[model samples]
Target: MSRVFVKKASYDNLDQLIAEIFTLYDINLRGKRVLIKPNMLGAFPPEHGNCTDPRLVAAVVREVRKQTDRIWVGDNPMRVQAGGGVDDSARISGIYEASQGYYVNVGAKARVISIGSEIIAQMPVSEYFLEADAIINLPKAKTHMIAGITCCVKNMFGAVVGSAKAKIHYDAGHAKRFTQFLVDLYKYFKPTLNIVEALTIMEGDGPTHGKIREGGKIIAGTSGVEVDAVVASMMGFQLNRLKFLQLASQAGLGECDLGKIEVVGDFEPWPNFELPSTYSGRPMDNIQVAQAAEIHEVWGQVGRLHPRFIEENCTACGSCAEICPAGAIALDPYPVVDEAKCVSCFCCAEVCPEAALVMPKEEAQTLFLRLNPQIREG
Candidate 1:
């Protein structure tokens, strides 16, 4: 059984919380090549709960400094706004200062590797990520439009640099396949430890943009799968509803069985935490390739919830169209989605800094059916 150490903490006492986990476990940081991957989605502030709190990351750096000086902190953040790169996002998110300029654009260079997934056969992973001896995954707890929740598992997508990430989404063409790809990627490129910052989390629609809710929690563990499972539970999601967690467990990577997990602190569900509008609480069955393909063709009809562009909020920056996985979104001087080709992945919404994209409540919920769980998906 994998052990997960969770502690109730505020951002102010982050070091003490992290220190407690170190005390509970034998997580050796002495003279190790440590790579810290923090959730730097874009240039969003920590208060918005869109990115990992840099203060918490700084605490991790301080803890490791006690053991070694060989440390590199970095992440390939999505270009959400015009004229902003990973450096901008890192700075705005406070990771740049927290890391003391140790932050690197790890995605700047890449090396191709076989992922062994049917949809994503191979990908160009960051060379720096592959070379690291000990990896500390710093993830912000948030709801993901596609993956249910973006924690330890979805955070690893940063390993794939540049436009290659969109290509995998296009290739997978389905949530189940995409989630399996994440599981496979974790199996191949994994971290040494998983630490989650749930002090403030994006609850409604996130990974990038959403409402901030105070969780006042810090969770740490060795297994990403186990850590993610616990986060899902905290967010009020059932294990089977999380495709990546289900796939990860099925792939023999980690255990999602609550009975088998060893938790080290207080555990309780966050009250009324809002899940994404399109999140179906129904459990997923076994991942048979043929079944996944069949589900892909018909899954969107239930919600048909695709993001509509708001011209007022749009800056004509073209980042959304560029980041669109299926190439379904195009710039006609403004961005437009080709409904026939679109898969409703909402990747555009994540990269849109202008907050121009929106899913209509009327569209997500019909008169006869509330296709979404709530009145609003966002």
Candidate 2:
């Protein structure tokens, strides 16, 4: 039976909780190559809940250091070929300081690994993941625009290096198929342990731009799927509608049923937690979205994941254009994107410094358009 351990904790009190996890479980990390993969969704600070808390990461490293000297913390940041690499995110998010010089640039080197799935057969994984004997995944408990909830299962997407991610997303254009791809990825590159950083969680539009909520909890488990199941349930997500969790459960990856999982500590669910808007209109019983053309053909002739530029927030950094896999974005007087060429991968948004690229839901955009009659008329 899979066990999910919930520890009531704040960033300051993480040591005790981490200690409990080690004491509770029979995990052996002594003298082994360990990779600490944190939820590094670009380069946002811990308080924003956009990425994994550096404090939590440092704490994990300290604990892991007690057992092994061969430990490295790394993540392949969502950037274009010319933009900042993992170190930039590490420096910005304070993860580099937390890593204490063991930080690695995941995109620096990679080894292609097979997902063993027909949808996405081969992918280049970060060398850290390939090299590690034991992986300790520290994912932030936050709602993602794409996968719904980016916990244990979704965090593994960082394994695929740089622009290759865009290709993978392009492959799984439909939301449901993309969710299944995540499950398959997790199942392929399964983490040894998962500890969720939920002290400050992202509530509204996230894995990046969102509102912060203080749920004040730390969740841990041996199986990534089981930990995510408990966390998703705690966040008041209906399992039937949550495609990632449902797919993971259906794949026999881990037990999503609350009855099957053993909760080790007190769990308080966030009833009013605001989920993202990607839940509706996805891969259904008959919807076939295998090609990019199908995406534009599906919803009002525009792709589901539309990358819109927030003019006020944009500083003309040209990072978006530089990083766009399709070269759909061009830096004119501002940034002009060729919608037809864009794959809706959200990489441009991921690398932006000013949080300028906001991918609002289609309905939300329509409502905004309605509010501004001039823009609507134009």
Candidate 3:
């Protein structure tokens, strides 16, 4: 049985807890090249709960240092494009300083490989993932607008370097397909250890924009799928509802059945925890109901949303233009969108570090309903 450990934790005192977890998991990094991958989603600060806490990252680095000096800390933030730098997000999120000078721009180099998924045949993955002897995945505990919860399993998507992420989203075309693609990617690049930063978690619409809530816990395990299963349970989610978790378990990547998995330490489901707006309490086996829920809640509304530029916030860095898969955005001094060429993938918005490109909820809902008249808004 896969074992998951949960500990009451705080940023102020993570060193002892981290060391204990390292020992419990028997994570040996002696004389081996190690990579510490954290969820550096964008430029959001630690207080915002968008990325892993720098203090937690620093504590992990200290623990890893005891085992090996050949350590690298990196993550391809959402704003990163091919050949683009991740330092801005890293620095802003305090991961750069917390990395203790071991940070590398992992997004700078990539190796394309055939994933052989139904959605995406081949994709470019960061070279650091290939070079590392072991990867310690540090994912923030948060709700995801698309995937339900962004925890251990979903965090590995950073392995896909730069704009290729957006292309995958565009290719998947829907929520279920996109989640299946995540499962395929996870199977290819599973991490050696998974740790979650749950001291401060995100709720409502997240993985980016959301409300912050206190969790006061740190969870660790060897298997990402098992770790996520524990996290999903703690967050009051019915594990089967999360498509990626279900697919990962079915693929034999890891155990999702909580009854079969062993849990260490005091664990209790959070009381009345808020889930993403996209989350549906209904059983996923009903295809018609699931499709309608996806359309009304996630894909139809969030998928059809177009980028709305904030002129004052735009620095004309051309990041949005550079990362647009359809070449829909152009920097006409302040950046302009050619709506015709835009595929509504929202890659441009995700890659914008300045937060200039935004998707308004009302506007997105209006557009989605207008485009598809048959699907009435709930």
- The prediction achieving the highest lDDT against the true structure is 3
Q: By TM-score, how accurate is candidate 2?
A: 0.86
RMSD of 1: 5.1
- Ranked by TM-score, top first: 1, 2, 3
- Assess candidate 3 and give its lDDT: 0.78
- Candidate order by decreasing lDDT: 3, 1, 2
> Model-by-model lDDT, in order?
0.76, 0.74, 0.78
Task: Provide the lDDT at 292 for model 2.
Answer: 20
Collision pairs in model 1: none
Ten-residue segment with the worst summed lDDT in candidate 1?
285-294
lDDT of 3 by residue, 1-378 (tens): 678999998788899999999989888899999999999987767777788999999999999999899999989865765324588878889999999999998988899988778878888889999899999999999976567688887788999986678878767766667888889888877888999999998875566666789999999999999989899888777776677777898899888889878999978888767665445322222121222224533544444546788899978888788878778887779889997777665567656656687655445434444434344343
Tens-place lDDT per residue, model 1, 104-129, is: 88877789988676768788888888
Candidate 1's C-alpha runs over 4 A off are: 80-83, 280-297, 300-304, 365-378
lDDT of 2 by residue, 1-378 (tens): 778888788778887779789777777898799999997776666556688889999999988888998988987766635366667778888898999778888778889878687678788888878888988999999876656678999888888888787767767665556767888888877888899998888865576676788878899988898898888788766565466776788888888788888887888788666665443222122111122222322443332456777899887878888777677888876788888887666767667777788666655334332333332242
CA error at residue 354 for candidate 3, angstroms: 7.0
